[model samples]
Target: MVLYLQIIWLYLPIGLANIFASLSRHIFPNWDYPLDLGKNYRGQRVLGSHKTWRGLIVGILAAFLFFLAQKYFFNHYQSVRDFSLIDYNSVNILTGFLMGFGAIFGDALKSFFKRQKNIPPGQPWFPFDQLDFVVGGALLSWPLVPVSGVVILVAIVLGLLFHLLFKLIGYLCRVDKTMI
Candidate 1:
């Protein structure tokens, strides 16, 4: 029970980061990105251009805070019920930053691939784009959290479903102009 609770708590930063990043779109209205597929790298900004520095900073900060919380909580108990997973320092601030950065990097990488493929920004590309950030974030945080294969499978299935549902909600809310 404690382990599960701890795991859920670890995701708080990630959730908060997403919320902060979403706010960035409205906060930085001047950030206009042209969805040009034909355009080559040309040493120019692509993929991650839509990702604001402010968002990154906020997201990282949120992750760091969450990590601190987790660390404090763990240090208080020093044991996770019957599990010893808490024996490691996986819940540190550094781990939180890694997870946050990993997730954002994955999203940015997906955007880059989408542009290269001319899939259009915000268009839903099955598997790759949808799971990119989750996979990246998970990979980054995996070293810290010793989640089992079953946990990973659960995460993947639930994450994908949640992604679709959120996209649908965003569309219905008219926040997402694209139906993808």
Candidate 2:
């Protein structure tokens, strides 16, 4: 039970980053973070429009802060005596940033496919759209802390389910028009 909780805790920052990215429009209306793909198959934006410099910055900052707090809290409590499993405080920050960037990158890749398919942004696109960010985030950070195969498999399944649940709630609350 405790190990499960610990694993969940490890994944929390990236999940929060995803939630923030989803809500970024409302959070920073002035940014005009291009959700629509620009006409030109230009240098940078070629990747995807939704994946903006602003979103990347915001995501990285959020992840960094979250990890910093988690590290600070863990240090203060000294609860996890077996500290070998966890990395140093600096490592947490680095890994958190990677997770954040990778998550946004994954979402952008999915958005690219969505545009290619002419699928509207908010429309549902099944497991690919749902799990992309989580997979990217986990993969980016996996080297830092190699988890069990069971954990990786569980993360993929759980991430998809969580995405569906969040989308349902968002639609019901009028936070989003649809789930994708």
TM-score of candidate 2 to 2 decimals: 0.82
What TM-score should be assigned to candidate 1?
0.72
Candidate 1: 10-residue stretch with minimal lDDT: 79-88
Count of backbone clashes, every candidate in sequence: 0, 0
Quote the lDDT for 11 in model 1: 53
Off by over 4 Å in 2: 33-49, 80-92
Candidate 1 local distance difference test against the native: 0.63
Q: What alpha-carbon RMSD in Å does predicted model 1 have with respect to the real structure?
A: 4.5
